[model samples]
Target: MLLIAVAMTAILLLAAGVVAYVAFPHRGQRMPVVPWLGHAMGKAVNAMPTGTAPQDFYEPQETSAR
Candidate 1:
């Protein structure tokens, strides 16, 4: 049935993604097993805004000199 075929395809794609995640080097390090996917992921990350640092939430304390 068409539903079975779709399920099988989904399973195969999921397996491929898992294998690529494990086998490939992280993005911006070395070449990945799947270049296009790595490039897409890198672009997506770069497009996002930078995260706030922990220091941003607190004021700096002044030290008293002896």
Candidate 2:
């Protein structure tokens, strides 16, 4: 019984993570559902930095070449 309960809890947490990812696809490097999880994690989370490029990357930039 204890094993089954633990398995269920793990599955539930995974499901919640999946759902949160789908719901906030553009949130950019956030903990699945618990926002504070990142803050609480502190140095651990920042240890390995990851990010997406800015949305304007493809846009033309003004230049003084001319």
Angstrom error of the Cα, residue 45, model 1: value is: 9.5
The Cα RMSD in angstroms, rounded to one decimal, for candidate 2 relative to the true structure is: 8.7
What tens digits encode model 2's per-residue C-alpha lDDT throughout 1-66?
999999999999989756665555335566656767544444454576799899999999999986
Overlapping backbone residue pairs in candidate 1 total 0
User: Cα lDDT of all candidates, in order?
Assistant: 0.68, 0.68
C-alpha TM-scores of all predictions: 0.46, 0.41
lDDT of 1 by residue, 5-59 (tens): 9999999999986666445534345344557776665666678799778874688
Give me candidate 2's TM-score against the actual structure: 0.41
Error of 2 at 12 (Å): 0.2
Judge candidate 1 at residue 66 and give its lDDT.
Answer: 100
Q: Which stretches of candidate 1 lie over 4 Å from their true place?
A: 26-29, 39-66
Query: Candidate 1: which pairs clash?
Result: none
How many residue pairs in model 2 have overlapping backbones? 0
